[model samples]
Target: MSTFEGHVYLDHHYPPVLWNIVRGGFDSVGLLPDGEKDFAISVSLASMLQNSSASRLEAELSLEQVRLATTPNSVSRLRGVFVFDDIESISRIWDSNKWGGHFIDEYLADVGVWAKKSTRVDAAWIDDIINNQGKLLPGWEAAAVKYWSGRPKSKDAPIWEVLVEGRFCIWSMHSKEAALKEISAIWPNSLGLLTHSMNCFGLGSLDGQCFAGITGNEAGISIDHYLRMIDSKEAEFIEQLARLPAESPKFFAGKPDLEKMCLPDLTGYSGRICAKDDTNLTALLNLLSQLKNETGS
Candidate 1:
């Protein structure tokens, strides 16, 4: 299968929780979990900070708590959690590698959270942990400060470099068929599978309904047929479904008019476009165009 390598960042809160989930998830599934599994996963702690009420000090304490909680467990199962506060700081830490720096900066921008300071000590500590432990994450570098004054250029490079260097290649697969084959080859007796379409986003009546189907599938349940069942509901619901697309006409148009259309909730995966009653129809058309290009729908 073809593989595309890109850097992934996680919010600080994500690693501790995600590690618990992955560890718990595999143990529950009876998979032969190992240290290598940690390398397969990368968590972006920076993303978690967007909604975090924890101050920097609180965040530091939280990390220590997680480390303390998990230390007794097998270190091999510990996944790496990379935390950064902002893009500019990350750029400085990475010695200005535009590719990795830009990728992270742009990602944070799109997600609406950028670090404001250099979190260097965080990166160093993670690096020390990984080094002392036998490289729990194969290709992943320890989380590093996105910015720090007088930071050595190579002291910490962008996490994406490891991805590009083929550390997580085992987890990379181009297509559903390839992924299935790879997984089956690895776990011949596995009977269930889960997949998520990252493309799904937004909330509104129709959008929320659409996400019901998306999330259901992600959770290893069949949902397309169920969605068809919803189509047969009351005339009111059906009519609303039909009107929902038209309500945000700009999503279909070549250029999206965000000003005219109400934002979708984006919490769920329905992927339905939504707009306000007074939204400008022309703007909706523009947004529709942009969406079509973005999704190639």
Candidate 2:
């Protein structure tokens, strides 16, 4: 029921196939996740809680490629990555404001306007689309229907609404700041600069995981530093959840962690791999996946 407008980052590792996925077109509605219903619902709920009119509920996803090495001096090869959203700006807006319901209502008044701009239809047509009873309305009608129906009836609603409501979590952003701030707080003596690629933003929820990744970034730190910060953030999120009421849907199983979240790094092994063949992306990918699995990443 509450609005959490934070940035989310999604990290996908592999060969440079992200470009293929983007060119293939990332459709939100048709490709429902197999086991992430809760995350999908959280996003649907978050959409209703947005401060702005989002008539185009479909998500925009893109990918970026980065280099990975096992060590600082080792040669590095390409890995697919993306910076899905810069949540710092939006997070400030939703977190600072107390107008949860008030803002949503205000934005609803413009949902028609948003639809008009996106679909290039007039107010009359927009109304017709919303009021339409047919199985299919027209161009973009299905998207409009999903958006309109998903609007939160009150500040709170049942969790099952996600099934009937539509998938809106595709519009979330997982902020890198979640890690940055927590790391700073936990390890005040640790000095490092962390940044993201800011190239892509996407949302997905599978197996209790709901996240928006604004992909890209090498966490310019050692493996120990990266894991330490990740562990700290997990603790912080767990603590925050415990303080909240049990009935609140805002608290979900997925809290950004090493398994679901990835920070770009050059490991010592990767550095050695680079030495074998700087251009061998396959070798680089194999090692990266191996490291990820071994570390439970």
Candidate 3:
């Protein structure tokens, strides 16, 4: 067995920089650029950075687990593999139901408000119709119809076969911008300044709303496996796909196989994008903080 020793963020947000690196595709061929691979993300999901002390505690425990399982020589060779590797921050109480309803409703309202403000539409009409309407009251299609018609005409305006798709796509474009802005506010020097594509493509809805997933790279290979792959020229990345066990519905909740690539939940061990420097990690952390403060989560 191989031993791994290195620093990893026990709690860190998967920011947009890594998102742009991995390919993403959508139902509409044009939604994502050519030759992109789709990765599913959880729309109702929210990421928050653990407190420094809490993060340190988890890191220490994880390191101890690595030390106990592998040999010293193996550990030495594998140290570099953990550097800047994406770490899985396990949630002690992983309950999606708690935030699912509120996040979906608030997200829709926020998107409606953004459309009205950005398009220079009648602010009162938007506020009166889209923003104020409860999730079930006016309904998503009703709101989308009002918002789409209310806004000024443009060739850029999107047309969707299903009204829900329109709500999802339109919200995804704008919400991603909002998310990037939030990240930029926290980390001014972030490399992922530009928004790229939507994650969680094929997955339909999340908690009665569209599943606009988070963007990040996948830990397809575990740290130990990554070390082995790097050491062996024969280890083809394609062959590694066979190592993944069959469908794990408990974690994925009926999401397709592609979602496994998008979210690193299946990879037993954790890693990080920046081990030595955590500036980029703070961008998502700060965004989570602001969100929790506002939402009371």
Candidate 4:
């Protein structure tokens, strides 16, 4: 699953009570989507995610709130939205050579460090939490964790090892220079995952009909541009969907329109691509430095 339809943020919490269902979501299923998961996102799609798009879906990007201090009640949270990933991109968390900054150096690699620090954990975890499980779903549907049922594998094995392993896809590890070059690019995977529990039915929206879930990660451009990109009155479909809980119903349902991925006032809106937080930020900072070539797609 190379796609996610929600918004994510690295949040340093003031209090769980302050955040817990501030949006009113059904966490009874225990699919608390926050932390480590967002880091697995790929740098390849970082720019595209930030760009404007014709197609869209709702997604929630997040990570667990880390407690930094007990005396003063200080905590550290991630500070960006990342929803795409590949092997190389996930590896950037540790290897600074590709990502420009050292994530492990800052984070200390304790979150998902199960036996070792590798993208395999992120990749496997994504499939488990997303593809294998699902978003805002009930408790029963959360499967895929059976792969590791046995604490220590009786015997190491590559179950699906023979699936043409050499067909490797090229990936980028979030280079500031390479990312800035593609700032003008547009996107098809438009989404706005929920940040608060406004709707009652699910952690998403009340009716679970909205496709885009906005939790304030990409600022408000994600939904504002989506609705304003087209004349709400002219496009009856978009107009109606906007009324619901930010869900682009029947939205990303169609294939991507590479040519039509534009909105109004290009210069004015693109500048609001949401700045990345410097402290413990996994993705951000696409400056106009000496541009580098994007490799591995």
Candidate 5:
């Protein structure tokens, strides 16, 4: 086994560079432009000076002599850097007609290199209705339902929900009131629903809310309850379908695959079958029946 060592640093304002070379150093590799190979190698004494931590911003003053002697060009532009070489000098040996196969096998065994870091701004875009709150546009509720079903136009709708799960914290830019309201409705119960917002961007400013939640211990229960609530609502819709003529029920087409659906088995390792075995069509029917009996439908 072989070992390699290196460090990475990141900042906003400049390009990346790498450095440091002892005489007879290891070959350094990096990403190549539009190449079929994952990476390429560059062996230059100047590359070392450009990437060295000793040559960082305002600090290069001390290394000016070394930089001038090594590269003959200003070293201020390169921001990213990586350096690696085999401990066995396998490349050198291979070059001397001592080996048959590539030295990459030995190189892979020794060195492990990683890329440097970079930064950028993140943002989201929200539509007019969600921007104005649920009340901004008339007939928004119907449009929301349609949007929820993936048929949206003109009016705005809530595209994502931000929940606080476990100990996760979120910093909201605006819409704290709406975010708090949604949190109050979901927290201490179902937090997994919040994972969808963790890396969200494009959720527009204003009319949109962002908040953080702490995932509570009862997260599983909360999630189950939330899903059941959705299932119950779907059950109500199915009940309505059962009452309608078969020809009129086409509106429910292409909705959720309730027939093959399976609910979580709260007690066992295997998921519970939502419908009966063999004939998967009865799960929705049984759920509708249960809902109707409870609701006096």
Candidate 6:
């Protein structure tokens, strides 16, 4: 097994300057061209940084069992990644090199690198945070104070490590961004859905409400009641799907008419199913479903 634990090296090549700028200093992606690949981040995800640039990398950071990008999409241009690579800080808690994003960070924050909140608090680690206050984010003074004080600290501590290690606590994700671009390139109106675990190209309502997303301790979501252990942004995505079924049963609970949903005969598809990826199949299904819903196809 490789000695490096949390690092993920990509196949792309670039000059070594990428890592030099961000190493122990900057967090901006100055080297890469400023494109959609550089921005569009959510506070909900863990960040990524390049440790070296001879090759490329993005990482999946998690302190809990809920997987994030367990197997990231292939890379070229990437985005929303954090820039910091002090590997020793996360070496103890990082799991799976299957690399990249937020679900991982959320898990880490809630559960922790050593274990969940409060259970694994090492008296020594608390002292480290107290003594190394310079490494901490001044904005989180209350949180650090709580850790040292015999008072209740914030439930999230991953930010503490990230801020200390990178001088900034945010996530950068390339594979998921690329995947979203790929999906939106074809269907501009569709809302992208990413799960905390058991991730896939899940379906969402036409209005951008997701049928699934991260819900800590579980991935499946329902409007009636669901766990919020995963995402800090859950309120924004409450499933209207469940509530609609009760008020507008015809649209929500009723089955679609197969006759009205039949696809128009089109030219044969030209793609193959890879042993590793079946998203092509999923996309094809989506395309056919979309065609069936067209008014005059």
Scanning candidate 1 in windows of ten residues, the lowest lDDT window is 194-203
* C-alpha lDDT (0 to 100) for residue 193 of candidate 3: 15
Candidate 4 TM-score, true structure as reference: 0.20
Work out the TM-score per prediction: 0.25, 0.18, 0.20, 0.20, 0.14, 0.19
For model 4, how does the per-residue alpha-carbon lDDT over 1-297 read when each residue is reduced to its tens digit?
A: 122122111121211111222222212100112331222222212333444231211111211210111111211111112222233333443343322222233211111111111111122322333321224223312322332221212233212100010111112222212222232232222212211112222213222111111123643322111111112234553444444445543222232243543321223322333434422122221210100111110
- Give a tens-digit lDDT track for model 5, residues 1-297: 122242112111111110011000111221222221111212221222223332221222212223233432221112113222322233333344432222233222212232222111000111322322212344434433342232324233222211100111112222223333444343423222222121111111110112111111321100011011122235654464444435444222223333323332222211222223312223223322332232111
What is the C-alpha lDDT profile of model 3 across 74-137, one tens digit per residue?
A: 2111011111111111121122233222223223211111010011121122232322212122
RMSD of each: 20.1, 21.2, 22.5, 20.8, 30.7, 20.8
lDDT of 1 at 61: 36
* Global lDDT of each candidate: 0.25, 0.23, 0.24, 0.22, 0.23, 0.23
Regions of model 6 farther than 4 Å from truth: 1-42, 45-85, 95-160, 164-177, 182-297
Query: What is the C-alpha lDDT profile of model 6 across 1-114, one tens digit per residue?
Result: 011112222111111111111111111121112231122211222112212211111111111101112212111112122222334435433443222433244223111111
TM-score of 2: 0.18
Instruction: Look at candidate 5 and tell me the lDDT of residue 294.
Output: 24
Best by TM-score: 1
Q: Which should have the higher lDDT, number 5 or number 6?
A: 6
Winner on lDDT between 1 and 5 is: 1
- Candidate 3 vs candidate 6, TM-score winner: 3
Q: Which candidate is the best by lDDT?
A: 1
**Total clashing pairs for each candidate:** 43, 32, 6, 35, 26, 19
- Lowest summed lDDT across 10 adjacent residues in model 2 is found at 110-119
| Candidate 2 structure quality by residue, lDDT tens digits, 133-217 | 3222355444443333333223332111111111223221122233334434533332221111111112111111122211112
Clashing pairs in 3: 40-200, 41-200, 85-272, 86-271, 87-271, 87-272
Least lDDT summed over 10 consecutive residues: which range in candidate 3? Answer: 221-230
lDDT of 1: 0.25
